[model samples]
Target: MKKIKNNFICKIIEKDILKNKHIKIRTRFPPEPNGHLHIGHAKSIFINFNIAKIYNGKCNLRFDDTNPYKENIKYINIIKKDIIWLGFKWNKKIKYSSNYFNTFYKYAMLLIKKGLAYVDSLNKFEIKKYRGNLKKKGTNSPFRNRSILENINLFKKMKIGKFQEGDVCLRAKINMSSKIILMRDPVLYRIIKKKSHHQTKKKWCIYPTYDFSHCISDYIEKITHSICTIEFQENKKLYNWILKNINIKKKPKQYEFSRLNIENSLLSKRKIKILIKKKIIKNWSDPRLLTISGLRKRGYTPSSIRKFCYNIGITKKENLIQMSYLEHFIRNDLDKKVNRAMAILNPIKIIIYNLPKNYKKIISIPNHPKIKKFGKQNIILRREIYIEKNDFEEKNKKNKKKLFINGKVKLRYSYIIKAKKIKKDRLNKIKTIYCKYYNKKQSKKIKNNIIIHWISKKESIKANFEMYENLFTTKHPEKKKNMLQYINKNSIIIKHGLVQKDIFSKILKKYIQFERIGYFFLKKNKIKNITFTCITKLKK
Candidate 1:
């Protein structure tokens, strides 16, 4: 373990395995294939994968696919893509809990032969009622004293589909009066007559409980340390109980850390699934949803996501991270990467009459202002150019800098120009403005007027830009009584715009800086032409 940046888990490895060079360090990231991977999962991926990389160990990508009803093949593929996209390479074969079903069944039988586990006929609700809360101790079930031979027959029957759902459950026969409720004879297996599993299809009707399978899966895979979030801390007692009764010497020890909690967003998979079902959001990949696919579609880079996780690090304490803290890292990552271009949203035309007819002048501007080697793009200076409509005000003011009657505004990377005339039609809207360009000698006299970005009216391509905000109105949206009450009504706003024709194409995934505007990403929609999504603002 590296002491310079040692996390709590690494310290455990140092004490447990470092002294004995024979035991190699190994870890695994096991995610249930139920939903799209979220940013919270990204933290776990970084911790598991990077720790292995740092210690010259191995990290396995294992899917804890215990629930066949909720798990989908599509979700598994998306998860695989997401992990690879985040720059973590796992074993090509991959691992699944369902793959160890036969072994898990045998382990259960071993516990039964030792009179440590048995088949119980109690329904789930009755069992939950008997398993009292923190204030009280639980009562043992009537079926807890069943003979080992009877339990073996019942278990085999459950596995062979002889039992229906809710009929019976196989449970670990631990002390019912234990302080932790999970140790009160927790269910080891349940009967579910489902036919199409992603990996194992219709071979068995019984599935192992997460509590029973998680620890054993790690043991079967020969993992050194089993790491998970703090919510599973209480379940650790149950985790160790299963491994202990089996008397496995070369097994893994579980470790827990705080999970990621971001303000104004909910990370619960079940809650997110509710939103999807209610049509509150478009889908899992909606730009405001914050899932891995959503973030990728909204133009967040993989490197930025990885950096955000690193900066947060691993802490024993749980804290709600401000959304702006994450925004800061992405803004910094994109600053020196994407090239700059000029785009005018809600543009108004400006005609420069000083230039002669049938004449054009080509001017150059650096792609990246700080790095000269990024090279320059050549744009032709035409008679007409497009500037934002907000740039032209009704009257000239001394404090505000815009295209006024006497205000001399510098066109970016070009000569100085002043508004000579204003034109508008119905509703008193400003449609066009006539301006006069200043020569090299006259340009030196300008002052106080701010420069603005624009694109040529004759050469620029039209585009639609979508600006996205948080999906929820409140900072803690999940706490609301009604989930719909706190939804942001206007989470998305669309506006027409014009971008420099020399660079922006109808289809491009690369990030581009739109001059005074924020960085943007071109959408991958084939039905719609030339649309951009706002990544973040560069105001900081």
Candidate 2:
């Protein structure tokens, strides 16, 4: 078993279990099957699963599929795939809140029996009007005084499809005058007609609201530490209210930790959907989006995402983490783990001025600098080679450190070379650079300040790189009510590059580090577009 890293939540769970030997440590990752899990969900996934692992407990993969209107089986499977891809296994087959629909109805009846819930005849708009705002006390609906028998009859009719949609709803008879708006007689169940549930089909017309079903589902599953994001902090009250009023024997505890918020990242599910519907992005898995599949397609390792969650840590305090902070973990993950190779983004030809006509040999370069276990790969080094265009400059600028013409610059994994002369086109653009390789025996005599990477012209393959940047122009995209106004037009930029022909096979199989550039993953199917997503250029 992997050693579990300690955090504030872990400390709380460990101490709780230590204090009470009778307490069972069972946690869960409950995701609504409405949308794909995003980077925000990753934090919750790590926290719940890692905490359960630390205590030798079981973690359940629960789907909160109470709302059937917006959910489908495809979403359920995708969610399961994401959790498994994140390196976690459920103790049993996937559980759904809809599985306990019968029990939930029984609990609703229990609420009515105890005079804690009633079926409101008022329509949706009237209910909202009665439930006043933060500044005013809510007015009670006329049907709030309905007898328990009448409420039960109406609720039964609701279950039997006797009423149209929004005709009647079961709401908890909580304090309407209370300052907390959520406690003001929140709707427990609503009737949905015509639309069939993905799980339950047309057998039922009434479905439990998320607030009413979430806590009960936890109680039914015996979840010990019901952890969630801080945004649900207000719902914790309602969570306990349902379990408390129903007199549950074993009630699950709800705890909220700060969610992962990154600069310029749009995490809201509704916003993501609008973006996709508007065709601003290709899909939910577009590399610019923060969905787990998007991150995976962008070449982010699960281990890196886990590390990022741990690095951010768990807390009640809210903050926006810089995007660079997330990239740091990816860098650490890919640095030593991936094979290193040279790829020139902008190729410029360099010809050896005085080498032998038949000069050609394979230059061996280590796959990784420190890890010898990765072995090495050989590149054919002919008399003519291609270097990055930026590596060659016609004239030395003031306040410059080193010039290729005056001083010898070491070619990565090869001998140093000095630029003897440069040829230019009619427009005075650099066409070719004539250089001579310093003697290998006396290379130490040459003063070389910088090392440059290059690939052989004959041995390199052409490919297109689609580099990515932040999706939004501002740091806090949530602040902007109109998200389209702040769309980053330059989020993705395409450029042609030259990578070694030998590395393409491994690139298709594993992540490859482009020496001075960044880690890259091969884009599936498209041979010319051999790039997944680039994080950022390496800081030299």
Candidate 3:
């Protein structure tokens, strides 16, 4: 639980502070509220919030909600919930880029008056063509040379919805001949005839682009360091250019770091949305997904995720972490905490023929090993019981040590039993295993070869158990031409199972380890006098 301080980014921030450069570091996590935050966002949040906390500075949760067509209030609320779930709190009230629309508009006008930016009449396709390639210089738009007065008037008209979508755009008047293509007059604003904004609503039709609004918003809020993904490294030049051109009192520095990537999942919101739209996935919060809500549904704890992030740390080099590493973290976190119970999956009836038919006894089982404070639960022992079919074998020739007919093994924490006979169905499939239990004191005198888990059939609860595996068959499912082609067909296996009667008495939502099996959570659906469902841990 000690604070992590070994990351290179933290060292850089410390170096800056010691040099008396950017005395009060202010950071911001600016997420576009178009979709649910993913694991990649978790890294950004951790770095930003922790840096601020380290320096005793401030971090702001700013929503870059300029795109009215894709942004929504639902996404905003979900983002807030996700940040809080990851254990981060902003220094002050939540802020949105849309709140500075009027300010951004005035700045755009300032650029026009100074002949630094102009309204371009080129359509979207023509603008891309004019922008040229990386090795070439772009041609100036025909409207780029328009008088400052005309360009300002056209920008005003676009704001009032006089132009159709993509008809006119505001572009920064940077050099087209510059080596960096992003420095070549990037589009600052575009016209969109969307319905309305979630916060602003119908006030304007023209919206500022991310490249234009991002840096200026940081300066407006007096941010000291703007941390973003490495993909925006090229955009950093334009970010600096806009701040230098504008008359901002304090300029913020932009830093880039590599975004996090998981081996077997798609992190793009667009791809996930397509899957959900095509019904390939159940929903956004499907347990197979890597979203926060999805992880929550899959029985992952917030603390475990935070620990996973901490272990991975922050870095500039991109990495593809194996999914097993995450599972290892989860197992390590839950092993000491979760209480233990016994549940038998794929059960076959075991008949104790030597025991009295009417005999019954209660045996005590500890809830947790090496933890005396957790107490114990009472398990009933009867004539009929259920054990996993995989725990037994039909023949002993191939495997002489196997648990077969006439073989001896200890029933976990109970007496030793010798298999008397195996009864097969008409198709020669083993249906019943008949055994004879040795007397209690006599069984304890001798050690059994194998220890197996079993539940009393008479007092057992019949339930349906679900075992989940990785949703993808390959390491990079999204990189393939068809994700479904790599889908793990055996991701989920359902079995008619049985568990000790003590487990059936509790209806809590918390997860519990099933002794030799994996962890399980109670399913929402309950059958009337017939069955119950529990979701098992994800297979490694």
Candidate 4:
């Protein structure tokens, strides 16, 4: 059995267990399926799922699909796929708030019959005016004093689509003078006519608000711990009040922890939608975005993400984590998992003068420098090859380590090569480097020679290398007045490159480290050429 770390929430659960508060524990990941889940939701998923795993409890994957106007069946499927990709399985068949629409209606009726809830006919603006701000006490609604029978009848009529949208709503009859405004008769159910719910469809015209449905769903599911981010701290009062008023015993408890906020990353679904709408990002799975789909597409492994969440842990203190902290984990993970391949991003041709024309030899290179179990890959070495343009120089400087004129450098896994001459194009750019190759025994005297990765021209394939950086230039773009100004123009830099044919080996993983370059994954796009996205730069 795995032991859970002693966080505040975990401690509370432990105390409950020791005191025999319950025989079994239940937790849930209740995401509203209006949009794809982001890294912030990854934290919540980690908490709920792992807590259930460590406690031998069951965690339900429940979609809080109360707002059918925004929610979609596609988004629900995407959410389920992401959770499964992150290596979590729901305790039972997937759950949805719509699954308990009848139960929720019954509970709402119970509230109205107990004189704890009332149907108000005030317009949205009027309702807002009556519900005052934090410093002011809200005034009672004009329809607040309606008789229980009348309120129930009005609610029934509202449910049956007799009232137009926003004309009437069901509200809890909590204190209007209470400092907590959410308790000031929060709207429970409202009229949203004609819009067909993904699940219920036109079977009903009324929909329950999140505040109303979330707690009830938790109670109906028998969730022992209604865990959520700190933004819901005040809502805990309402969550308990609804259960209490319904006269339900053994009510679930709501615990709040700080949400994950990374520097220069946007986790808000509304903001992400705006970016997509403006064509700034391709979609929810844009490699540059921090969404779970985006991260997976960018070659971030499930283990690495889970490890990152565990390292960050659950805390009530809100702090913005550095993006590099996440990069560090992926680097550590891929360093061991990823195989090595040679790719020339900026190619400069190299010709061995001493070798015969059509000279070719198949050589085996180890896939990983430290892991022999990864085995080796077969690559071709020929007379004509390509090396990184920056790997060679015409003019030799003091202590220059690259293949400069009359300077020597070792071609990795092959031979020591010394540049003899270079061919220049009309633009004065080095077109080709003419060099001589020496056997390892003959080059034994060469001291402090740098080794460079190279690929045979005939055996290499054309590829595009996509380099990615932070999407936002500033650390706290959310605080800025015009966040669009902070968008990093160079977030994605594409370059045409050449990759060794061995890169297509069957044993290769989704992501591989380009020798002398950074890590990369085969890009999944419709482009004809083989494309790879740079996961990250080599550790400095």
Candidate 5:
């Protein structure tokens, strides 16, 4: 385990605990099971889990699946998988807000009996009108003065599905004149005639609101620290108010932290669903999406993501993390463990002149230059080879930096080669470059300016290389006039490439550096040919 630093927040938390200000430090990550987890969720999971780990306390994984209309078992399963993938484990059994439905109902009844809450019969519009503005006090609802017996009877009828949707709601009896709009007699329960919940089927019709259920749930779980995003900062008053009013054994402290926001991506589940529905994106796991599954499909390791989040550091202020910073972490991780291989994306055929026609040999190359014990692989050497087309220059007289006719360049892990002639098609596009190999031991000469990757024509494996770039051209895709217009049309470029045949014999999930190119992964397409997906590091 890494050492914990004495930061201000940590110090504050420790001081509070030392003075017996709070009990055991218990934190919980309460995610709504409506969509796949994104980068923002990663931050919350890290903070909650790491805080508990540091304090020798406990962190619970709780799904706030209150909205049955939007929540699903699929989302719940994916969220659990993502949290475990990021290397976190709940101290106790997984929990859901719906699990406390009966307890929440009892609490609501208690509030009604104590004259702190009541059942409002006003419709949605009338209820909002009575709730009033922030500057003025709201008028009491016509049913606000109903007898306690009458309110309890009506509430029981609501549970029996006798009330129509939005016809009645249970509202707290707090001051309606308070400046905080949320504190102005907020609704505790509402009527919803939607489908039954996954856990409870038609057991009750009255469902508790988030503001009412969140605090009560934390209190029930005995959570000492209720960590949440900044959006809930305003609701803190209500959170504490509920705890203070309720006869709970312990009161949980509500702390707010900035939510993670990535550039060029939308984190809202509704917006992502719209994109999926409109066919703007292929699916939730589209490479362009910032979901955990999307990043996994793009060949990112869980460790890389965890490292990226840890290095970004936890803070209260909102920060925009650059895509480049993420890429830098991934590149740094792959550089240490990935084996080196040769692959030519834009292949230009190279025919060696003055070489023995029947000669075929295998040249040994180190799998990793830095690790000798990692061993080597044999790459077939032949008279005909394929090199990247960009390696060759048409006008050698003017541009002397690259490989051209009669120019010498070293074939990586092999002898040096000099271009003798170039072949062009009818349109004058270079088709192939005829080169001649020279043994350095015999000639005592070498060229260091240009080094290129190549594969033997006889033993090369045909590969479909998909190179990816940023999905959006702008940093803020949501703010653009038309997000679809900002989609990088050239984000994915396909190329018919070739790699050493030996590279395909292994099924390694590990990253492999393609000599002159970038890192790549062998996709699980299982075709006779391999699909090498290029992992383009985001520039920092």
Candidate 6:
């Protein structure tokens, strides 16, 4: 494991250990299983799990599945798979907020008995109106002063499905005129009718709100530190209030860090759902998005992501991170690990007129330019091969870098070739280029010549390459009223390309770079055609 850099969270943990405040440091990564995990969640995962690992402590993986309205078992499973794919494991068996449904109900009863909470008869809209905003003080709900017995009875009725979904709820009896709006008698429990939970199905109708469940769950799990994002900083007061009013012997400390916000990206699940609804994106795993599954499918390695998170560090101030910052890490990672190969995306046929018909030579090239241990790959150099269409020009075109009539260019890892003449089809397009090959000794005579990647016609496989760009055109798409309008028209460009036939023999799930092209991952390997997703260009 790399040495974790000193951050504010680490400093706190160090102080706690030095003061003998905690013998065994414990943390938990609590993700709500309502949607797919995005890159932002990955930062939290790195902090909690790595903190525990660094301190020789424990970290629990718990699902905060309090909201069953949009939660699903499939989401829970996918979240687990994503975490595992990112190279992490929970300390033990996974946990869920639903696991403590009965205990939460009992705690709510305790609050009522102590006259700290009461059943509110106001509907949601009315409750919001009564809660007021930051500028104005809220008015107490008429039901806020209900007797303890009456409140408990109403709460029981809510549990037994006696009330409609939004008819009534249980609210903590906090000061209505408090400066913090969230402290103004926040709802502790609400009724969701006929909706079954992923873990506890048809067992209860009343569900605990996140503000009520989170701190208590931390207490029950004996978590020493409850880490969350900066948005939850205000809610930390309610988190502590629940723990304090409940008279817990040992309370966990809550710390906040800035959430990861990428430029030209949407991290919110609600907004992602909107994109899916409008068909702007296919699903949570769309390569165009920054969802963890999406990144994994797009050929980003776990180590690269971890390194990015570590370098970014934890901070209280929120900021937008550039997309290039992330691309740099992935590029640095794949540049050293992935094997090198030759491919042509816009191919044009080239025939060596001087070579005999059906001539072939086995050529060996290093899998990695610098790493000898990565070994070499053998490709057949034949008389008939395909180079990129853009590599050749009909005339000089004022650029001596590209192939022109009678111009000489060196093929990557092969002998130099001189374009003698070209064959044009009836449409007046360059159909074929006739070239003459020169051996290694004579090839050394050519100076300042451009080298390009190519593949033999008979020894290549057909492939579909999906090249990706930022989904949004603007840097801050989320700030706009209509993010769809900022969608880049050419975000995903599919190109029919060719790769070496034996590339399938290389390791699957490992990224491969086409010389002078980009890093790519084989998404689908079929008998006739393969699908490769371009991770990033060779340079940022």
Q: Which number leads on TM-score?
A: 6
What candidate 3 gets wrong by more than 4 Å, as runs, is 1-6, 135-137, 177-179, 397-402, 444-449, 504-509, 525-540
lDDT of each: 0.84, 0.84, 0.82, 0.88, 0.81, 0.90
Best by lDDT: 6
TM-score of every model versus the real structure: 0.93, 0.94, 0.92, 0.93, 0.92, 0.94
In model 1, pairs of residues that clash are none
- What's the CA RMSD for each of the models? 2.6, 2.3, 2.6, 2.4, 2.7, 2.1
Candidate 6, TM-score vs. the true structure? 0.94
**Winner of 4 and 6 under lDDT:** 6
* lDDT against true structure, model 5: 0.81
Error of 2 at 235 (Å): 1.1
Compared with the true structure, the alpha-carbon lDDT of candidate 6 equals: 0.90
Model 1 alpha-carbon drift over 4 Å, by segment: 1-6, 353-359, 395-401, 504-509, 524-528
Q: For every model in order, what is the number of clashing pairs?
A: 0, 0, 0, 0, 1, 0
Residue-level lDDT tens digits of model 3 in 308-345: 88888766787788877777777777766767777788
- Score residue 494 of candidate 3 by CA lDDT: 76
> lDDT score of model 3?
0.82
Residue-level lDDT tens digits of model 1 in 1-540:
332233887777767765783266788999999999999999999999887877778999999998898899999999999999999998557999998999899999999999999999999999999999899899999999999999999998988888889999999999899998888999999987854787888887899989999999999988888889999999999988899988788768889999888888878899999999998888888888779998998999998998888888887798889888887878888887877888887888988878776657788778788978767777777889999887777678766767776567888888799888888889887878888989767887766358877788777877888888788888877677887788887888888887767665322347888878788887843323678898876773
- Displacement of residue 112 (Cα, Å) in model 3 is 2.1
Q: lDDT score, residue 252, model 4?
A: 91
Q: Write candidate 4's Cα lDDT for 247-362 as tens digits.
A: 78878989999888899888889888988998999999998888999999898889889888888878899999999999998999999887888899999999998998978888
lDDT of 2: 0.84
